[model samples]
Target: MNGIFGYAATAPSPSREEAARVRDVMAARGPDGHGLWSSSDGRCVLAHRRLAILDLSDRALQPMRCRDGRYTIVFNGEIYNYPELRRAAVAAGHVFETTSDTEILLYLFARHGAEMLSHLRGMFAFAIWDDHARSLFLARDPFGIKPLFLADRHGTLRFASQVRALRAGQGIRDERDPAGVIGFMLLGSVPEPFTWYQDISALPAGHCMSVDASGVRQWRYTDLTAILSAAGGRRGDRHAALADARAAIRDSVKAHLLSDVPVGLFLSSGIDSAAVLGIAMEQAKHPIHAITLGFDDFAGTTNDEVPVARRIAEYYGAPHNVRRIDRAEFLEDLRAILTTMDQPSIDGINTWFVAKAARENGLKVALSGIGGDEMLGGYPSFVDVPRWVRRYGRLARLPGLGAGLARLMRTVVPWYIAAHPKAPGLLRHTSTIGGSYLVRRSLRLPDDLADVQDPAVVKAGLARLEIVARMNATLNPMPDTPQAAVSLLELSFYMRNQLLRDADWAGMQHSVEIRTPMIDIDLFTRLAPLIGGLPAGIGKQLLADAPNKVLPDWHRHRPKTGFSIPYAGWMAGIRDLDQRNGKAASSNGLLSRTWSNYVFQQYPAGA
Candidate 1:
């Protein structure tokens, strides 16, 4: 992974020093080399910190311009299919000055312009300045595997791979975005296009924006849900679908392993990680390393992943490393973990530790199983949300009944029921896929936001978030089947906002690149047609039925106890969480809320 930062202005041009300062702040993301380029007229500047994953010479250094010097780019991602793209570009009369993907990308853009995004496959967040057109084009990858944050304020447009780096730019302020703060409180992470800062915004995943003398125009270059819907209703033969899925997954894993540096797998007892591990090992030319994280509190319990992960690693003949965390170690790393977080998230601690372990073991890149659940229906939302919507959706029509039940649930219900969070709001979202998802995924129910956040902020945030309306806007115009609906909701909300963002920050903090083969856009486009119409649980079967049978039954059949830390116990000691509140920090729910608040306090968005 690399870091990219740049600025474009229609008025007073920003100085090179400002872009360099942003680069300095993000140096950890790309320690290999650094460079800066600016237009002669001083209207634009681009800076890059290179990690040297591909084409490891100085010629590959970025902020690169085309052979004709008509186009300049500062890019921060790998183009997994660049070899093929390069071959096509060469055949199409495009000349490349270097073997770098950056050069290939620049050439491709020169030939195809914005149309180039559809021809590429990989994670990317890049800004290309068209010297001739006098326009700046910025795009993020399909699934948001990479990040692109922008601050468009004070007559300047500044962008970076990390939000903090964008904040480092001149003329950007740290004023709190009420919607973003409320989003953090509701979802434990801020949603796209709404960073914690009022002036800063993330470019939504799978979308691109162009800035020129006229104004800013943005559009979705690709839509996963639309792809899924177009491919829905194809309910192919089960055996054929399974075979296709297995083949697609294997091919995606092979593509993801295309880095110059050694890559490893984050092996867990779960089916997702195990499946990825198996595929990666089969494709790797050398012994692949597998890492597992365990907690001392779960040593003798079924919750421990180390033992099962070790067995799977041994079966594959891969070197296995188990990093066990005792309370003492967790306590020691608490400060660093919190500090390294780019945003306030209750999750990502597991990723932080696993990535740290991978770095310690001399691995520069590692693969994770993040998208498996969203892609293959592993989450309960696939089943539960649909069931709830089906059961309670009709009752929602009886005007006051739904609201009355929600009021009762909020005032008198036990915390366990309340902790389900979305239960009360179930009636509201029951009518549509977007609404059902909000109920299923919300950390704090709509009625309960006042308990954690200011009433004014909550009102403003909810209005701005327009949670259901915004979600509905991302949906396919065609109605989605139950399975496809949940998949779309999860991918758009939880997976994009939490999982992918967490993976990026946590992995990069330790200088380890984390790849998710299951998260590939091309793979999803291929498999969506085959499984989009299937019922909730069949997607898992499709993924598990690999032709080689590399996964053992024991590991695959094990109950899905999510990869978790003993955060409740850890927080009790670290924050005195148990005694600070009137209630015990007995459940992950309360502990999560406490920790979320603490993380926010430590890294306040407004600050």
Candidate 2:
């Protein structure tokens, strides 16, 4: 990904150089080319590092200035429908000096301003400076697949793809904001508008912040929940919803495949990735390279959908290969990963392994199945959470028994599946608001944390709970069901922290670009309206019922297993170490011990 860093004031050259250093630090993202530009009046400076993807011509090197010299932009994303947008722009008699989408984006903004965001469909987070208007325009995508950091320290405003990029600047981050760090540990990553250091903020998804000397104002341009509520249940019924969903998926995959570079597939035994492969194969002229990942020596059942992946690949006569991560290498890579993690997360390692394979296979870009579940009610949480929610009414009226029953649940369930059957994994995953599933789902609930751990840690959690509660209150004004809220929670939390970060860094570690066809902006707008009123007994039922133009039944049944990790089976690793001494390490809950020991602690038949 590329970055934008600058100072709009007539400041010291060294100050601008410091901003340039922040942009330069992301060089691993851009090895082929780089450039920096300063406005003739010296009031603005823009710097960019590049990875040559499309039209790898020198003309595409950016910090691109508009023909009228009224604007400059530094963007980090692909305009998947660039060719189509180009046709429209050209028809309007707009001239172009380069074939890159970066140019089209600048020109589109010149023509449409913020309105340009709705017409373009791809993952993006960008910053634009209109010198004539003396304003800075910044935005992130509806799905937030790409990241942008915004920090306002004193009077200067700084932005970049990663916070580290912003941190590289000398004068930025004047305050050591521990509140963000507290939020990070409590929430697994800091929430939007809060960063590890206090002064930095993330520009939240679907929102834009426009700043100039007059001051700054932030506004949200999209709200999927409201859109879904307004769309209602009629269009989302099983038959009609499926049709719109199918059309959206195919169109998005087609647009995502519009790169000048050799694109490949990160095929897994899941419907999402399989759907991507299936759709791309129809339009692709040559055999596409497909990749599958596995653990060769581990004793646990390998979540190898390699068999399923091969079934689909062989059926299509597509060329494919398998890559393995033996136990030893997984350990070795895990250590390097921790230091390189940029953000501490349980994901990204899976992406690291596969993206490395794709890079070696000579593909510069790959497609993923992200956003498929959120759009289609594919998660069990969408179903199971509501079940527990029904039971929650009974718990509330019971008064004193509520705490007792929740605690009783903690003791009976096995560590492996303690919350299983009672609560869906989704509700248990994040600390999102008002889901009854939280009773069955939490790793360790607030009371449990208060009872067993450090009081200081518990107090810290309570403080962040206050923050999340306020956020929940803010979102309450928008309308939708528990399902829609759960979907949004996943998007805000897991998708950003786990999936997208894993995909981007792992791919970039090899300079490979991983694209998600299912997450196109227009496609999301179309599908968001169809998600609310789903029928029971069917998962991703909407997508399943659609008349798929290209995918076979083999791919059609590919469950969303996602990059499966062997979470069970006794292994001699830090997992065991973490179990024994990892209590202090857990920001969430304490891991449970073996059954015999727990039973020993209780032991009387009627005790």
Candidate 3:
């Protein structure tokens, strides 16, 4: 993982010294060394902060010059398939020096042009300067797992890994983007293509843009939004979908485990985590290394899941390493976590810490079960939406007290299902604007957000949610079913915003990389449609369907417990101390809360 910064002028004239300043400010990202490259007349400048992962040799350090010397590249991320691409290129008569993916990426474009994107199957964000065409091609991975930012102003085009680096560039400052801020506070992370500052924007995932003397143009090469934003399919076909899910996911797991360095697993005793462990154990010739992630607050409660993790390890006979985390450890790491956040988010703190542990365990790569819910109806919302649709149907046809009470209940109750835990689980399905938004990401409802709404935010959230609903209506054609469409919208809008961003920054902060097998194109494309097709069941039942022997009985039946930290408890503990000492504690220590109150002003408790 590395930080990349560069600027292209709308008109020529940013100096080398000014470029040097941008490099200096992002030094923490690449403490090992830095490099600056520019065209002969200085129409552009590319700066790289290196965090040596692959070669550990100067040859691997980037802002790399091309084989024919016509192109230069500044890149971050690993191309897991580089060795194979290198072999094919070498067989086709190319030469190489350092065994680095960065160099391979340049030549891959040199040989394949735009088609190279289709060939790439790893996380990445890279800037390729084609001297021959006098153009710069900037591309992010299909998943948007790596981040790239662009700020265009006064005829200048600027880009970087973090917004701070962009802010440090000469002749640049931006007004805050209101919608992006509110999106962060309510959703816990800002959705892509928008940043906290209005003038700056993210290069959407699965997209590539090129800029030169003529100007800039962008094209999307792949899409997750289209798949997840659909309605139900035929229910009876699930048996085949389950079969497809099994083969496709197992193949991705095999591909993801293909790393040059030691690979480990993050096991949390959840069905998703245990499922990955089962496949990993089957593939391992020797004991596989696993990290059981947990916190000290659960030390006294039965919430400590380390024992279950140990049982999985015992079953697999793998080497299990238990690493306990505490509030002090969390507080100590809070500042860096803030810095690691490219945008404020409530989640990812736990992801960052786990990656740190994975790195400390002498591993460079790890596998996580990230997409099980989207594929198999794993979330409670997916299971209940079908039931609520039935209840709502009955009420619409009735002409009595029950009908009036049902309408009254829905209006006063945040949702119809709060009457029982199962109801919250059911009606809170991701089918409509409010319910979909809440199901996927919101820590607070629109009603919950009502307490902290500034006039601007109310408008923006409503507009965004309206756009999402309309998009779902247009995209999802399945009749009599809204679950699949809701799942897709949630995955596209919220997952990309919160989950993937957290994985990228948090992992990079610890100089480690995380790979997800379930989201692999070949896998998800086959399984996602079958989710809402089945009568109410677990969101990711396809994952658990692998075999009864593979998972714990409790895990198979457990409620969907997010990979979460007890943030409310953590916050209250600090609050008590502040009251006693007559000082205040920052909710900023928690990304979600920080974004909610400071950025969006929408925490349920209010500032």
Candidate 4:
């Protein structure tokens, strides 16, 4: 909801002007106010740009200090359970200064230290400056819903809400990270713990770090895969599971409506967004405003979401706003969109325009249904990954046999099978849940990238990224079922690295906060027990029935086309434009793969 930047160093702190420059780089994220706080000893500084969603008073402004003067904090996010946490703090003999979650966080940290993270139920990326301890503590939410990028140089650590902001600070080196560039080529987005710049890295989700005279230390406090694995055997009755899921959805939707300003919903034809709209109408004290993005190219076609979403809004009796865009608008906004992008991504173009429409309509916060698929087995990966593991897992265990067979097929098989890019990977990766999921989700395989990128860069990047190893680690002890394993892979990698990260930068670019009820930790906790136990497709139906009335049969049974735009056709136009102008453009391979290459070429590392 805001932009935060600061630094803690063994040496003197960066100049106040320099820190403010970093904060100002994210001015669009927080247009309401700005502040800077520096320690008297010049060891640390905290700066903030305020969007003023929860409490619109100067009293709520941060870098806020605790009453005891021991702790000062700068935070960027909402703590939905702060009202409950505040009551506990008051009972524990703490006095309050303002009705803001940031104050409650400072008091809780004073009382519980790092243990306070477990008590929180919201999205956040924050840094607390302990003046007395002369140490800095930084933590990101369990889902990485908010971003925190860090750069350490000469024992000085700098943190910001954005990678571009950190680069604008002019303190970190501008050297390109080879792993990061290749990561974008392979995955269409730079994976966490790495960034486009060698000097900057994203803080991994569910993790925290501390910097002091003892040097910096980082650790994980929560792991979603571990939680899901631990709850594997507790498969209760199907009816009871459905009831629990409904209650969790309602509770999460109500909590996400915590903003003081009017809240809105991003309505779509999909079950995920429609379900959210229905629940919000039932729970919100006021009428919920709903917004949907429609493309002129698909206005009369099945791909357009406007008509279906409008009918859903009418059924809920909520105010609806539809924004229709055309190819001309896409061409005009392409430059600004790329510049606003914090990293190279084949995704986020849809999010960018939708968030822009929300802001234009005077909405400061909106709820999205992004995480529903990953949590409820709505993706094809759920079926394909498990089947691959079951059928070809034994072949993978034989190691060289699988590899040798794959090589033989590529060289000697029929042209269609031999020329297929993923055919060899399917044979080689079908052994483990991680490998199978990779085959399902990778934008371009390592072998595919080898045909485009330098072999040395591809080799080094794969080694540093350790893509499959990292994916498998999320399933640490391994889930009890293939379904649960695929869920962990999708949530831990695709959602964490791409969906959630894209939502953050895109929403912030337009100064709108996009909240995801489907992504809540509490909701996931309540439904984790029944992940692999329930019948296929039943989980989504449970969500559809969460509100007072079940969704229409036509709405629930519609084939999943996903919320998307006409990107392929539009990119073809862009390619044509570039070719006519004598500029190089990628014209071969899958649209997503070529789009990934084009995005990197425009926003290459260190640019």
Clashing pairs in 2: 177-198
Model 4, span 20-93: residue lDDT tens: 88889898888988888887667787889988898889999888988878898999999989889889888888
- The TM-scores of all predictions, comma-separated, are 0.94, 0.84, 0.81, 0.95
Collision count of model 3: 14
Task: RMSD for all candidates, in order, please.
Answer: 2.4, 6.9, 5.7, 2.7
What tens digits encode model 3's per-residue C-alpha lDDT throughout 182-215? 5665567776777877778899888998887667
Candidate 1 worst ten-residue window by lDDT: 1-10
The candidate that wins on lDDT is 4
Ranking by TM-score: 4, 1, 2, 3
What lDDT would each prediction earn against the true structure?
A: 0.79, 0.64, 0.66, 0.83
**Top model by TM-score, which number?**
4
Instruction: Please state the error at residue 338 of candidate 1 in Å.
Output: 2.4
In model 4, how large is the Cα lDDT of residue 233?
Answer: 77
lDDT of residue 211 for candidate 4: 85
Cand. 3 TM to true fold: 0.81
In model 3, the runs with Cα more than 4 Å from the true position are 1-10, 15-33, 225-241, 282-287, 300-302, 385-441, 445-450, 460-481, 526-541, 544-549, 552-559, 573-595, 598-607
Residue 171 displacement in candidate 2 (angstroms): 4.2
Clashing residue pairs, backbone N/CA/C < 3 A, model 4 = none
Model 1 root mean square deviation, Cα atoms: 2.4
